[model samples]
Target: MSTNTPTPGGPSLPQERRLVTAIPGPKSQELQARKTAAVASGVGTTLPVYITAAGGGVLVDVDGNSLIDLGSGIAVTTVGNSAPRVVQAVQDQVAAFTHTCFMVTPYAGYVEVAEALNRLTPGDHEKRTALFNSGAEAVENAVKIARTHTKKTGVVVFDHAYHGRTNLTMAMTAKSMPYKSGFGPFASDVYRAPLSYPFRDDQLDGATAAARAIDVIEKQVGADNLAALVIEPIQGEGGFIVPAAGFLPALQDWCTANNVVFIADEVQTGFARTGAMFAVDHDQVVPDIIVTAKGIAGGLPLSAVTGRTEMMDSAHVGGLGGTYGGNPLACAAALAVLETIEADGLVDRAAKIGSLMTSRLHALQERDSRLGDVRGRGAMIAVELVKAGTTEPDADLTKQVAAAAHQAGVVVLTCGTYGNVLRFLPPLSISDELLEDACNVLDDVFAATK
Candidate 1:
């Protein structure tokens, strides 16, 4: 429909996958050595291939290996890396004074970005938006706003949820090995409840799952003490787990009845990544507050907390905002991203991408019982690995398959509480041919491993 396929590599890099050498060629290995010396140990890389250019569906690495980009930088470059409009906007904004600090001298870019968010997010009710630097910051601020509005302290998150790395979000997150390991004494009053994981929950229906979760909340943390119930409409880092139908609406209804703020953490699922503009659109569930990041500003570092006007305003003046919260460059990039999504009809593109991926993964699942489940919406899809003839997780196999894909010049990522899900967040800019090639590679990898 819309012809906005981004040429991030300036028309020089080919979109097709081309492997000049091994996966981590000599040049990339050299960069890795330098990175080991310069960067912190906590910072890790998945592919370890230093990217020199990326555009369309391929990432050109240092050794001229043009690998197919299936991860989209963990769903950050949904509009494609170095998208035309985003690049132009950032270039123009940087030249025209980068930062005046919104807290000091406000700029129109910040206001415009907020307006776009307020209008674009799920819900027609009067809303306001506050920008931040990362998903964790937005989530933390969402809690702050909810607490101020509801006058409550308790925050509820779902099992297998991955909020962020900040101390507060770490407590909210479910996994511990890497996200929360050694990060002790997490924030207080954060509670975890059950989620509607259909594959692992014995094919539990949505209503029953919601009831199960509601019982936990009511019995453990009473409604009166709860400030907000934060959830990812489609859980991200915890696996691309799509909750059973009616699950989200049920939670929203319960939150409404309890006077608790319903916050949708759309950090990894927003901006057309999940086919719909936002994942909540699937169920028509309107959250009291929605936290967005990832694809909001193409590839720039920007996050936002948008919600009802009253609740957003409840926070006292000077309560919100940071030094580099709504930097002009980020805001400008966000504006371009919003425009690109609208003008280029990316919502439909994401849906088509989802259909292609789902079909391919489902076909693979039929041949291999190890692919326990294939689920997700739009470009955000995943296949959970399990032992044959049983749903027991096979995290080891997941690592093998992902490593194999990486070595073959396909950038695949693994996730899940058990670390057995191979999640795919390919950029919509990817052509059907590239998508098919990636799927074929997976097929070969699975067969070879078997």
Candidate 2:
């Protein structure tokens, strides 16, 4: 792998944190002004810093600040931004041809990606894959395939779930104000069920939580009517909520018994994010349909729905496809991303990162009661903030801490249903020194938070 900027036109970025001026310096502020005037108000920026280049574990902003990247652009650049392999693959593919539209004239890259997904994804069952542009597209396709296979319309999603922003996915998502509020009337026949949120429901064990959710599904949407149960093994956007141990297995069993497709939305937790190739791997639970994206292509816009051969083929010949579903460039990047994961042993690296971050956060939790819970696996970790003595969320504190971290040249992110969870998703390329620096910054910010 060459040590070059993954993105063409950008210089090779160094892997360290360095603040030249402020968080959003003059240039970024000017860009923000332009964005306000030209872009839609609905589209928001988290840190308000315009990035120029990103590689390894830092984001180089237009202001020349090298911010320690703890967010990985919401877990998209798992193999690191401008990854050498991805860069070379994409560059090589682009030089050959940009697009012929796989539907019109198929390419080998598309079939290769499908074959890779079939092999990497959990289960030894014969599987088929269809590519898409984003996680939502993959998820929407998964639901379509499930309904077609089972011949049922009812779909179940869990509380605090965030599948996507599409009409169908927006209906499936639990959060309302931002993702749903005015987007309705959303797609119908979508129902919400309880999730095994260990932190919130400490009284209930994994089995109990699964039982509660199963009861809701059976009572409200009977097995005969249900087509699928879509879940994120470790919920992202809703919070890095790692469902209790037995919860996922129990649900998988139920889905199998009822013949409902169990779809694992691994968009955020897939591709060695949660110390494993996929989060469901932790529990050895095999979903009938698995949706993947984000980390799959080292920052490229690509997603896939891989499932049992029969269920995936249930859709008609012309039923599943899009114009730029599996672009050669994206396919090339994905192939490289997969190679990097295996060659570099990123799965173990993620575990190391998780252990280091979890330990640091756990130490912090001991000193600050407001840091209520430190949960998650691998590099995908989060700390839910509360009001010192109680479980009541402290969204304000979360915002303040994240802002402080950003100002201090560390790019962290905030998430969770109540908006009180500070999530961390640094690239596997990040060094122990960088991770320690991020932890030190968090320690200072948390101590300062009231």
Per-model TM against the reference? 0.97, 0.97
Model 1 lowest lDDT segment of ten:
1-10
lDDT of each: 0.92, 0.92
Colliding residue pairs in candidate 2: 6-82
Task: Report the lDDT of model 2 for residue 201.
Answer: 92
Model 1: lDDT to the true structure: 0.92
Per-residue CA lDDT of model 2 for 123-152, tens digit only, reads 999999999999999999999999999999
Measured on C-alpha atoms, candidate 2 has an lDDT of: 0.92
Give lDDT tens digits, candidate 1, residues 1-450: 112334432333566777789889999999999999999989999989999898788899989998989999999999888888889999999999999899999999999999988888888899999999999999999999999999999999999999999999999999998999998999999999999999989889899999999999999999999999999999999999999999999999999999999999999999999889999999999999999998998888899999999999999999999999999999999999888888888899999999999999999999999999999999999999999989899999999999999988889999999999999999877888788888999999999996
